[model samples]
Target: MQLNAREETPVVSVWMITYNHEKFIRQSIESVLMQKTNFPIELVIGEDCSTDGTRKIIEELEQKYPQVIKPVYHKSNVGAARNAYEFCLPKLKGKYVACLEGDDYWMDPFKLQKQVDFLEANPDYILSFHDCKVVDRDNKVLKEGRLAENFKKDLPQESIILGSLIPTNTVLFRNRVITCPKEIFSVTNNDTFLFALLGQHGKAKFSNDVQPSAYRVHDGGIWSSIDNLEKRKSGLNTYEQLYKVIDSKYKHLIKKALFTRRLMLIKQNKSVLDSIKYYINSYNYFYFGNGMYKTWLKSHYDLLKQLYRN
Candidate 1:
């Protein structure tokens, strides 16, 4: 006798937040529409008063596929983080949430189905992500795939504090906890905070698929447009502030990551004197003292390679 096989119900929502993305919003939306899944899925888009024709396209798409596209058009720009937390995310009705920005798109038609299947089978895992390809403003493939080595299948919350291991567009997470705390709004890295929050409930999984989404790099990108020096400084300051708000046990890991970022910034500036100053400042902490000196010395070889590549 054959046992009965039951199908899972539709329980996924795709949230897209966009501003001035007329150039790429269509592709992003189409990618979600192209997804093949047995369960029902909704695409909730928040268009933040885009000065470009982004809103026009969104409206047209909504008309054509009113059943699938749920749009929120704002009169004034409330910013991405605020728009998502305050207006967009809370309205989602799915048991699970997948995110994509207007500028980035999923490459796999089964992207949502694959991630949803994973989470449904593994109840302990709060989130799942996959590798992505990096593309330049012109759509040239800068890198075939971003993940150089395979990450652990399941990563703990504290382990992810060092940096963002998962790309924003590639993540699919449970909607068990949707609201962001008021304090988190003060911090600049909302994705990190969101992922960290999910991690606390359970571990995050990296899908075996190496090609899922294409991460776009352009002048308008919030973080990508900043110079390396300023970006590193901003990163350090952000982590310091984040440490104050996060769980006490994760503070040590955050501090260590900040020191690593500081050293990288110092090296990138190509100033031996800056390195000397950093070394002096780090003397107060034994962990950062002599070890950093050796690390700095070893970094020069990689620096030369970067120079040649550029």
Candidate 2:
């Protein structure tokens, strides 16, 4: 899409959440500034307390560009969960709120424009997200597509329930349709919770294009920065929490994802009967887990395996 540089820019509230992203924050902000669209932007920098010098750089940028950049700086290090809940949501003031975390950047100059144009034209969709380039700390390209790249026309509701989001940065949601309730973010994994909430109310749009935004994965990444033991335990805990927050409307999709997880876990641990039990009886266990469901699942799995093999 060819956008004229002199065109008037729409008022987009760029929501950027940052922790200790001193290495990539500057490039991230610069990517926003390089957009071809002519629109007044209110850059909302939600600074989760970083021990590193990230806050200082944001302060410097804000001071240098007084009109465009505004900050929501916290005194202490509020983790990612609390930061999104308390700092960013309340400060969001644009008709179209575009999220770009401090660690990620916009690769396409027309990205904001393409998304804004679609949202403005198609008023039905309350939320929209796109594919982003996966990069490393040194700005090396790891992958070229995003979560929804597989779904160009309509993202399967099943996929949304999978809760495998590309990155928070690739999303640009309408503020009118959704807001981060403090209750929602207080959970273990806030991002998926927020996305699923949007799914509950109205339709969401996803772009299948090759490159939309840039997501930098590094040693300091949200999940990678942790120690080995804690990472393993925390990941499983986060998964369970996400399984809890998923809205009821997409229960089936969530159930499918759960089944897939069960199968994978069983294969890894070599628990065949346990896997079958988890997969088949997830509907019964959706509200709460039960031992009876496990027995039923084992019987069902054995019968199916015998039938197929025979």
Global lDDT scores for all candidate models: 0.76, 0.66
- Tens-digit per-residue lDDT, 1-310, candidate 2: 2222343243677888898999988998888777776556677888988889899999888776666677888988887766766667776667788888899898887777777888788877766777777889888888876555455444444454556463678778777633454456535556666666665555667765526678788987766466654433343444455556556666656554444344434333334555455455544434323444564455456546644654
Which segments of candidate 1 are over 4 A away from where they belong? Answer: 1-10, 150-154, 259-310
Q: Write the per-residue lDDT of candidate 1 for residues 71-116, one digit (tens) a residue.
A: 9889899998888888898878888999899999988988888888
**TM-score to true structure, per model:** 0.80, 0.74
lDDT of 2: 0.66
- Candidate 2 ranges with C-alpha deviation above 4 Å: 1-10, 146-149, 156-159, 162-166, 177-183, 186-188, 208-210, 224-264, 269-310
Candidate 1: clashing pairs of residues:
none
TM-score of 1: 0.80
Model 2, 304: alpha-carbon shift in Å? Answer: 14
